[model samples]
Target: MPAHLPHGSRASAACLSPVPWVWPVPGCLSQGAISFQFARPAPPWPAMPPQAQPADAGRRVMLMSLTGLVLGCAVPLSGKRQSQSAWLRPPGAVPEEQFLARCVGCGACLSVCPTGALQPILSSSRLDALFSPQLVPRLGPCAPDCTACGGACFSGAIARFAVEHKPRLRIGVAVIDQARCLPWAEGQRCVVCVDACPPQCGAIQLRPIAPGQFRPVIEPSRCPGCGIREYRCPLPGQAAIRVVP
Candidate 1:
């Protein structure tokens, strides 16, 4: 037998219900919309070992390779600035001080170079030459007839000139190394250098040394230093005839 509970009391409501009474703890009421939670259990944490860490060796290797690739490309692009003393500016280039001040490094000349002779100087040690345009004779010579680079320069650093007027432009003077020249050193009859000089320039003059042999001479006054002779020199490796700044 059970005793009767008081009216309007919690014990009275429990006693009236068909289900058995349970303590009002967290998540204890499953059928109601209201969730009256006083306490909650912590979630299980994921396992981690003390020895587990990032792979230092793999990360280091990747970093080194990326650095090497960047420097390797930069060597050709800007590392050659050490030789800038011998670097010749494009034809119609303004005076050195004025050119440096006006050049915007737009690389317009690099785009229109038909012979790919014009190259932009990137990453120079000197701020004046950085990203400026220069001529690379080993690749090819500035064609006597081509005035594309001059026209591309809108900054006035490189003054635009007519193609017919290029003959009067003097970029540099070619210097001959007698020690490496085939005609002067080996006494070989090589007229390649003289023959390659621009027509009507009279930049390269040949003097007869022996029968069927002649030594090439550069007339500083007449030579425009176009570097065509250096590019066509018969010598291997470095050209016997090179343009000087």
Candidate 2:
């Protein structure tokens, strides 16, 4: 016969037993006795072998290659789009490809522009055009007699020339929109563009059309495309005259 023991004492004895023991209580005995012990934390999950790491390395290489491919394809397309747009380069600038190759993107030319017409090409999808100098005639017209941009260009992107040679250097051509010109559209007398044009090149001429009515005509051969006519046009929005390269 076993010695009689209180319920709490039996529970304590059962916990202390060297061999695992389960409480006889119906619900408590379902999973057998609970036991605990300390052992080396199952030696840290074995380091991923060198062979396994190649999968991760390959993934990184593939990602880098894809990125390069995307950039390569995008660059040519961006360059093509830029080429098709009207880009008004400063006077004395070389041919498109040569100028792009020679230009160092220094702002020297921009700094020396007397009329503030030369502006930096700040934003462009093509990386090469970024920071290159361009002419924004609406801000201020390039002085026909000034050779500052060519003189300031250390990169030879803009050829250095004397003031005398500037008349022959055609950076772009000015086109008049007859639909927007006041004289052409409304039959009004307007010679603002002709008056503002540099006298050295009589590019814009007022031709007598009807009784006391005159229309502006462009003489391409004499025009240097200095942008004076476009800048001085009196129309409210979008000047009647525009310069295109």
Candidate 3:
């Protein structure tokens, strides 16, 4: 051709042959692999609206109901502290309502009862008295030695275990139902309640009425107020010394 090298010459770029231009000539490769190796583009963001979260009505109701259910179950488990019955209570404890609320009533306090002093109130009493513990001294009397029913009542019915230490609780003050007692009404020779007393506190003391017979009377200062288990006293009405608030 004019001034250019021949088309077959190595000098001609298109016709160059075994020149070994690259030290290690790369093999034929797919463009897809090269593309895959490149960095990816960033993802597009969603376009959701910024709405305010609504209050969960169902969840609130569930929580309220659960709270109510727990409180309902706890009421009876603590024994009838709210009950009108005098027997089922923490002896000597003040601010009774608060004490009973925290009480576990696990019967642990009932076990340390060295004396059978803390007896259970039986069916002979009212229905409200059901499953409640009363101090019954049928076999003997409230052990002069053991008065822990007060201290043991983690519920705080009374303050301490020792009756002496315990500021005299008006648990159930004895009322000598003159209408019932043998000396007062029936005029018999019965001195059971008087003799049954622990002697330290002579709740039922005898007074020489006639020469031969003595009438049993309650020394208001002495009677602890808890009723009898033997069902002996015969008040014309309910016991004169019935439990009161």
Candidate 4:
């Protein structure tokens, strides 16, 4: 396990390419289309100079302002979010900037993970998280038995997890989403999630979901956030899921 983060200082990998640059057009005219002026012979009737048209001037000013706004909105975006973790970077993983620079925004980990711990976030606050990933434990817990993300990560965020000594990671604690769970919903005899957890140092244990029936309850102290430092995840595809920052 790494160091415990302070309250405000902490919050939240994969890689991605750069966005094309967009700039304002030279003229302040509207996006498209133009109006035509009627051609006429020299004005024979009016020998005096023409009067100033404040209204037309104002309209042109308005149009120019609008043109600037449209151009501003059209500017292309820059770098995108990543899906892996910072700590996972190994000794010779590709150059951090270069690797992140070209990664496309596709979530292979989330799709293949068994426990459904991985989730796509809207933004990344720092350089490390750019294009990397976040773990949403509330949504699901990390799988304790397997380290599929390690093997499946093309970017090596989780790296190739060769089930070595138990990992000491402490990503976050689990909180059930009663909405999607079977025991919480039907209130019947079911321990699917608990039965699913690995036995040794179980991150999750069974407790009373109802008066008679029991449901898997997370044991924070024992859980290593998907066995990154332990081995207790209980999901088939993903290790029990986590919402690691």
Separately for all candidates shown, the number of backbone clashes (residues 3 or more apart, or on different chains) is 0, 0, 14, 43
User: Which model scores highest in TM-score?
Assistant: 2
What digit string (tens of lDDT, one per residue) describes model 4 on residues 1-245? 22222245322201111211211222212433122122333665868888876678788899999996665334322344344444333212244454454334366666776766566654644433344545554445565555665566675444455454344544544455555455655665555556555576577766764467876567777655542321233333433333232
Candidates sorted on TM-score, descending: 2, 1, 3, 4
Model 4, backbone clash pairs (residues 3+ apart or across chains), number: 43
Q: Which candidate, 2 or 4, would have the higher TM-score against the true structure? A: 2
Give lDDT tens digits, candidate 1, residues 117-163. 77878765555567788887877898988999888889998889998
| Candidate 1 whole-model C-alpha lDDT, 0 to 1 | 0.75
The TM-score of candidate 1 is 0.65
lDDT of 2: 0.78
Model 2 vs. true fold: TM: 0.69
Report the number of the highest-lDDT candidate.
Answer: 2
Model 2 CA lDDT for position 63? 97
* Of candidates 4 and 2, the better by lDDT: 2
For model 2, which pairs clash?
A: none
TM-score of every model?
Answer: 0.65, 0.69, 0.48, 0.36
lDDT of 2 by residue, 55-166 (tens): 5878889999999778855784565543323578888898877787788888999999998998888786666677888888888888988999998999899999999999
| Tens-digit lDDT track of model 3 for 105-132 | 4454456666554554455323333334
